[model samples]
Target: MNRPRSTCLAVALVATILFQPGARAQVTGAQVRDAIADAVRHLKARQQPDGSWRSRDRYEHGYTCLATLALLLAGEAPTSPPMARALNVIAHAPDEYTYVVSLKIMALAQADPEKYKEDIERSARWLMRAQDESGLWSYQLNPVNYDHSNSQFALLGLNAAAQAGVKVPAGVWQAARRRVLTTQNSDGGWSYTFRGSSYGSMTAAGVSDLLILGGAVVSPVERGVRNGVAPGCGRYREDKPLLNGLRWLGREFSAIQNPGHGRSNLHYWLYAVERCGILSGLQMLGRHDWYREGAAKLVSDQRADGGWGTIENTCFSIMFLAKGRKPLLVQKLQWSADDDWNPDRNDLEHLLDRIGDKLGEPMSWQSVPFDAPLERWLAAPLLYMQGHKFPEWTPNQREKVRQYVEQGGTLFLEACCGREDFRNGAEAFLAETFPLTPLHELDSGHPVYHAYQDVAPAGLMGVDVGCRTSIIYSPFDLSCHWEQANIPLLGERAFDLGLNIAAFATGRRPLRDRLDLVKVAEREDINEPPPPGDPLVLAQVEYHGDWQPDPHALAHFAEYLNEQAGLRVAASARATRLTPEELPRAPFLYMTGHYAFELSGKERAALAAHLRRGGFLFADACCGRREFDASFRAMLRQVAPQGELRRLEPTHPIFSGSPGFRIESVGYRAAALAENPNLSRPELWGLETDGRLAVVYSPYGLGCGLDGHACYNCRGILEADARRMATNVVLYALTR
Candidate 1:
């Protein structure tokens, strides 16, 4: 009643608003992916038949926890077979060691805590009881000897469990933080025992513990880094002890071993370093590539069967190599279109999986409707959109897209089902979105193609899409390809391309930053290497049985790659035969025909050797001919046992970048109508080895389109799209 006496007084009350900070830079997704995949390959190969990975001695709970955590961090879902099995092992096994119990708590916490609510709370309670009066833990719970190593694990598990809604006494955390801070040595690091000489592993552990406590004291050195002041520009600031500990780790950084200690717990120490870096958002430990350099050491040491000598070592290495356990989430927009935008698209998960696999981080996929602010999704590193035709946006909606692009957002647009109307609509929308800037083709030398992998540039023809800043547009039906593929790995090129787009969108550098780095490198070089020269040479295989269906095809491709794609080309495509000697010399080979063909034993051997030595081959049938298909499959089986044809996915890099482009298949239109109606996907198959495509083949005719004069002669990918595909293949071969 008093407030009602003055309406103005009631209106005077205001709410305080806080502006969110800009997105922080993330580690290159590709770097994370490669490391995690390598570590996982090692873990999986060594896992026992019972779903446990065993050390030489026994199947330890700690190993099981670590392995599960590693796989979870590497993007394996909780429901995934390996993760489910590992969890079951931990759930069934008895908990004895404090370390084992703590590790299990942490692993379960990363998974759904509610799903394992009783287990997590029970394990967490055990840890609290196990903690020593000194606010630390030791390997043995009953003896109550406090040690930094055990303390770190106890704190980690507690924090994880607490985050999952388990109650941890506030005093327990406070006491632990105080204990760590008080015990830290003057050098800014810690030791296993109180007041001991500071070492790298212990220091990292100490820093990580304090970070979890959220009471880390900021030093002047750290403030300067965070605020971009003198003494620390372009670096993140951390708490004082953290700064000191990190400084100590940096000073002692070694890829071969953990700093400040011998190699006894090298992998474990490396894992600690990774956690510290991730938590602190530190990109580099001084000047060393902490993730990459560390990965090389671990990968080189991995056994052929894919495990370290011990389960603990394997788990530690896997966790370190996979980075931390944080999961990345990617969202795709759901919008109005001619085709059903929310069609059953189960295959899309594979794309997310590939991205996660490469980055060593798990990815959660979401579908966001357009009703909300676009920024809600754009705030993410990447967003995808696919439909046959886009509905026209209101003026307000258009502004949202504009802001999304201008505010460091990336938009991926694909015209589904190869619908020209959709492609045209997308172009119009783009034009309206950024009228001042015309869409331009990317050059082959663009960093996007080579960010994580060297990608082939699409030759002269406009492929699936073109890019301008944060936007990528394509007319090809990528969803169809993703939906139809059986093997997750087959459509790597499409994924590679998508990754490039995402990388560019999320982490695009300013032109000035690039130039500055270049200048710095030039100034620092002791011996300058000359820049790469021009006049690139590509060799093609001239094999038996009409391999050169369109003799002019090579010349057309050469011209496009040379002039339009920004490469200096030789006069003609270098020709080679299937003989061992010639095959070895042809790094990029093209083989195609409608007739059956045979290879001599020498040729087969040479072909196998060529593939092993990193040669790439592109084969196409002239018009869906069974004869060429049968012969090529037989020959591939002979040349490489691993050369089974797997259908290409839509996310392959071949569909991205300049030399990478997407194409619609003319034959697939008929296939869709005749076979399943839901299968409007053009199919490409690949023979892969050691994670690289050795051969790409199309049973549907690509030769007729390349011939330029025979578009009507075959049921296949259209002429322009065919040219785009050929360009993509040639470029991929040359670079990959």
Candidate 2:
């Protein structure tokens, strides 16, 4: 079940150093978006007046179907004029050729499966009838020979049709799987025809075809019976042919050209690669980051007209980028025996499918080995780890897991079959990894319970890392329930909880195709030491109760200052106590927490003395907690008895763009805006002493926003506005 230790260790080291923040790819998420938009515009402009695109004379119907599928996958609405016209053409098209019929079925199924169900079913029947006696597909019915390309498309079309509630015969899948296994070359690759040598396009086609056929035979719902204790539980081990084919594809991988056949039908090959990678649920093919490399190639290869060579090629490239760039929802941790970690093979897939349906967007998931590098681990926002037995990890592995979680990754642990041993082991692992923070049972009021769907409490426990609960644990059998076809009431609750967890972890933000680039930019600014000079040091005041509720907020805000105002600031804030010795080193002191706290008289006197020395004090309630807000306001009263805290006017320097961004109005989070829709202008309070803005405070949360992530049900200013406000305040403080 586990890879050889030497191989795993070597790959881990190389992956770690290669994908480090400093060595991120040059292509960014913005550039990819621009390229996609350009391609979309090109396709729109190229649409024929008759609502069909013609590439080759004889295969115009197939070309049109390809174009329509590409556009639809790229987020084109079916009701749009271009898509409506295209759909109309496809709906009324003849089903004479196998290629055209297969493409038409896929397009219609994706466009509006329910609305075009009959068309999809009819096309699927045509494809099923066209299958050769040897369980392969050719250009049309009664063909002498069958090719891998045609067979792959036929299976893809049928799969889409099946997903749209069509009942595909099991015999069709069984025969196809058998033939695909038998035809695999000695070198593990596949050829266009049985007599020819293997190449990239055909290999991809072969691998994807097997995956489709295999998945159909042993569906997600049927996978529930494994449950780790059943006979033949090692399903992955049994898939030797699939594994061999993957190894071949990995060995001959390329995004620039079809391997072994340079530049010939490269777009078609890339499309096949996308399908293979997606179906296998893998981020890497051997060592290549397939999506990243492929996206970069496609973006660079685009012509001035925003197309790639021919219309068919353009459509293929578009589909590759559109479908391949889907955000990763979760990565199931592959640790221990494969059966132990993934008893129910399709649990994450099924859960993601439901989540995708709810969001009206495509979501992806993958299985990542626990020994994988930190970069690979951080690719997805959430890491889902489930097992029926205790996970015995080495010291190095444990440390790596700790690093991943601390650096903005959410860990979701579940005990399969409600195993007490796994639950206890998970608790111990969490305790060891985060000694300072212990897992506590989450209450019904916690955000995870209501992030999306409001569900009753199911005894979920979590560990608070910085401003959010980064580690969540469930001592129950959720994965088994997820694998059920017609989920029971308890299974429905499990899905609801899974949805909420995903929403909380991702904040419903679109994950970039290349998240490493963004992470690198942020890390270089926030984690790297400042230049050797007199840099402004933003210090956090250590206090009685949960003062460092957002441990990363100050550093992230310092990064904002460096980026926005060209300020020379320390990469990390210094945590200082309220004493004379430590107070003078930091002219700007930040104070924030979640719980109510009273300052000792000595601490109060020290703060008052610091303010007398012209030092600035800025504070905000973490997560807009009422206890902290009230306590902070009271502390200000006691510290400066004569000064009254007053709301800063819109004309105040912080709001009037004295430092940088103008802030006449700001956007609030949904929870905050729900209660105060009319809230617009900044609502910051200031207490002046000797006509200097000695103290500035916000009752609403700012730290969570400064951390550059959303907190479900958190009442706060949005990230952009909060960053702007923080920058203006820091600039004003330094000058005043």
Candidate 3:
């Protein structure tokens, strides 16, 4: 909840606030929402009854499409009256103009891709046909006049269409890339027309287009600034033309108007500024918030009737405030085998979902055959391969995987159900690939365990090792547990493990420091009561049935909290059944079991009261099974119907913030992977009362992940990960 906002106000035209040390404070999400609401009301009032906005002769289609997009960005549902009206106009209009066709394509793609797929593809075809020989687009369908303004919109539409499943020619993107590269002036900025004097608006548009087309701009100076260098900032430079253009924009940054054109194209300039900053992933431009500053100007400049006038100006202003650009997904690879590498042994869907959830962005997954050109896999930051027996790679394939690992690409290998072939083949491959840097055992001390969550080693199974080159190998079957029931269900620790591996592979170790952690205190007095006011003491909850599957689990976790997080606690976990008398002193109660059990009326009342009194109950099943999972849900319903178990959002504080940890379960059902490979990803569930987490539950047997204890024929999260989750839960409960 206290996350620093990444929003940046517009560049300096309207904003006079100079950048200074400790001067930056993020605009909260709530502020952005309020501004959007006002903008949306203004747009709605300006809409025509026919769902179209007034436009220049023959440009009504284009204006309507643009306005529709703006409304969508302002949180208008696609089916809303205004959006539907605009879509209807687009659907019926004879979209002959190049700009109209292009804008229509984008609007439809965003509004309802499936329902309007045919229209989108047809418009896309028209756009491709309308392009001039110079690989640029003009406003007119076949006009010789071409400029970056028209070209940028065309490219934007094409990109949107491509994502909506419209097949765009590979050559289209290639040719566009070439055109932008050739048009760049020596000064690293573009003009309205190629080779013309450089200007701010056109430069931003140019950079955005190039980035969209996958062109890298070199920054002439580090941080893309030159003159107004923040004192003490280090000097570093990458001389890409794109970077150069950004530097020029930063230097002449303005939210009020186009620096070169002045107020002539103010709204247009703001829209281009939004695209450039967002596409480049820069929150600040030369110490300015391009978005925040631009938004403030637009809000203040709005006409009394809520329209910026000229229809075009209003549309552009809405677009700028909406910040309407989706983050591009980084390419990723999943190495494939001809036979065994398939539906069941795959965690591609789960992995992407986890990455999206954890990173708060979307990710696209691509599959590469085992024998595909090594160059193919090299482009991705992470490559996943899991099977019972990894097919022996051709010598070339072997060399490729090696090079990939050495060149900072990560290769994740998990044996299928502890398959001998996979384990043996993987080890052999490692031996041949890196004879000098042999695979060494990975202990709890490794950076990977504590990358996101503080992980404790439970020695789940087999030998897990890591090489210096961001390479990690697990002989156990990790995918199976993740893909159980085709839905990820192992545990948070399991998900955390997978996410940490991916993050590390991508060179993003947000939680990099491996804290000088001490083992948890396992010295809780089993029979004695806690001393008065021992606020941080952990209590073990005992119930009937197969509880205490891992008798020392709670104690191990309590010790982890004390040692890693420095929380004061009893030497060991205290055990007590559901009793009002026994529960008052402990604010945190931990429980787990492998079988179903019923709670008596008195026990139910006691449990309910404990939770209502600010007590936190954390529980997990010993083995992921229907019986225990069902019973656990039933018990929660009986204890607190309104607080029945529900899945925790990936962004929940428990997953981030205080403990900021994640974990994953490894291994799988021998034949289950093949049977259901498209299930929903695993999740963590909790019961809440008064907006505070009252109970934390995991279907996966987290107990098995403690103390290297193995459950009877059940897979558990690795010890390191289990302990990490344990630490996080304690931290979350105490702090949140």
Candidate 4:
């Protein structure tokens, strides 16, 4: 009902002033109407209990003048009852109200015609009386009483009135512009009711008004205008009064950058950034996607009330809540022909059939359609957020996924939908664990793009397209906008690569798919037990989930497991194998050629128990049983959340010696490795809070699927990935 708190003061470019007259105005006729509406609400409230205004209430002068300026701003001539009542109220106020009232008279002039011109002339004359020879408006004619806050508002009212076509004296405008600009702070923000310190509200008021007024100022009046682009005085090296103003306006309390800065309670910055459409301006400045992440932060901070409000913090909080009204789903879906994408039952059936073949099996290749009839179209590699559930899995896929984890394979997904809901369906299908695991903002610093830059579109693509990709280039499409759904073929160099997205979300302690952080002890205590700890039992068994292993591979796995765990299970015992009871005693099992079937019945139970009992099981398929990943997954589900296992990395103490072996050296070798790869796809694995592996695969495996497979030869994975795998196993087993 009242003005939304602070009545007047413009942000950035809004404060541009005109000395001679209107030059280039940012405040359009329509925008002025909106601003006026805001000002009037507050002015009307300031019409005191005494049929007059009181200077004690800063609201009185600021809003009254703001209302007048808003009306003048739009040339909305007002002589009607509302205008006359406003005028009468101004007349009843004291001398302290003179500076503000002058603008009021200026506004009243627009509505009164020549027939009633006397009022207009009289109003301008009264305004002249408010200014002193010093060229600045003052409180009770006292300069000290009138600081940056009051003075800036008064001059803005003056500028607004002048721009409204009123014949403001040339000298009055020039003097006022100078007075205001000089008071701005180095930070480009304003302090409490004045100069120096920068407050979000004032920064908005001052900067907006300055840009607006300056935009309207005749060129000569701005001959010495400081866009704040020089090193004269300001935070940035550039003279960016206007830019800095906007920056301050958006920079309330949120340190939207570093992970440590800006808590959820930081409300002001979010408020300013959202309402200011700062992103739009930044785009104009060529900083693409600059505000996308900020927009996300606001969305994440929304309150349960669907509104952001904190007592008096309501104005900004509400603005923030309203900033990102909805996820910026590219192709912003509306209920139209494309709503369902299509409606012919035959077409739907065809798509369904294609999906069946593309995925081969229903459960294995996930596509969960939400129960809501409205969501029938989200069928491809869709995604559902944590809040939702995946469609139920068939009994077979369930076991299949379970074994896949045991075998150490990750499920990668790329998803996007409009008014449609794919993630909703995805939730129903992948009911393994981490229904809500989300994608973190992938910075340029991430190595995904480096993994295969031109070969595949590898960037940290956010789940929401509009938020991630600012400008989609496409010479192929009719228009320039590159629509992902339309470009069926891999367009020149395009593919939403989410290799780690899936591995990061699922995997058993996958060695090569994620953050392979291994502390390198450049200097180890040579006198003490060696890191390799007496050769560190460098034994490894390469398990390719594609095919079952021969007895030799099994023997390698068993012997390596026995040695790493310090168990004396002889290679001769390979025929019957030691039971689960004998397996836990071994501290480690560093073998590859992963296959749940090769694992004896006792081995599987012992492996699960071993994990629970802090046993380490490093499984890296050496390309033997490529398809048995399902088998591995099926087996591990029986132990913990299938999503828990992740790939290990080059740094997992295994690479502590070399400190560089990763996916590039090896290959993406589960079922089959990628060709002409940009990087290697080796993974490291770990457990979560419940002792379930935190990683099914490495989320930060640098170049896992890019270059040649590091696991191409039996010697490669064992010599490279195997060493790290061994170290992790030995350490985990001993620690556990």
Say which candidate scores most in lDDT.
Answer: 2
lDDT at 727 for candidate 3? 73
C-alpha lDDT of candidate 3 relative to the true structure:
0.63
C-alpha root-mean-square deviation, each candidate: 19.2, 4.8, 17.4, 23.4
Off by over 4 Å in 3: 1-28, 215-239, 303-305, 324-736
Q: What is the C-alpha lDDT of each candidate?
A: 0.61, 0.79, 0.63, 0.35
21-61 per-residue lDDT for model 1 (tens digits): 22322344444455567667777776677777664433366
Candidate 4 residues 97-190, lDDT tens each? 5545554544444344343345544554455556655455665443454454344445544543443445666566556555556656887676
Give one digit per residue, the lDDT tens place, for model 3 in 522-565.
Answer: 33465776556663767777778655545455666655666776
Sort every candidate by TM-score, greatest first. 2, 1, 3, 4
Better of 1 and 3 by lDDT: 3
lDDT of 3 at 413: 70
Instruction: Give the backbone clash total of model 3.
Output: 45
Candidate with top TM-score is 2
Task: Assess candidate 1 and give its TM-score to the true structure.
Answer: 0.47
For model 1, the stretches where C-alpha displacement exceeds 4 angstroms are: 1-60, 75-77, 80-85, 142-144, 215-238, 324-736
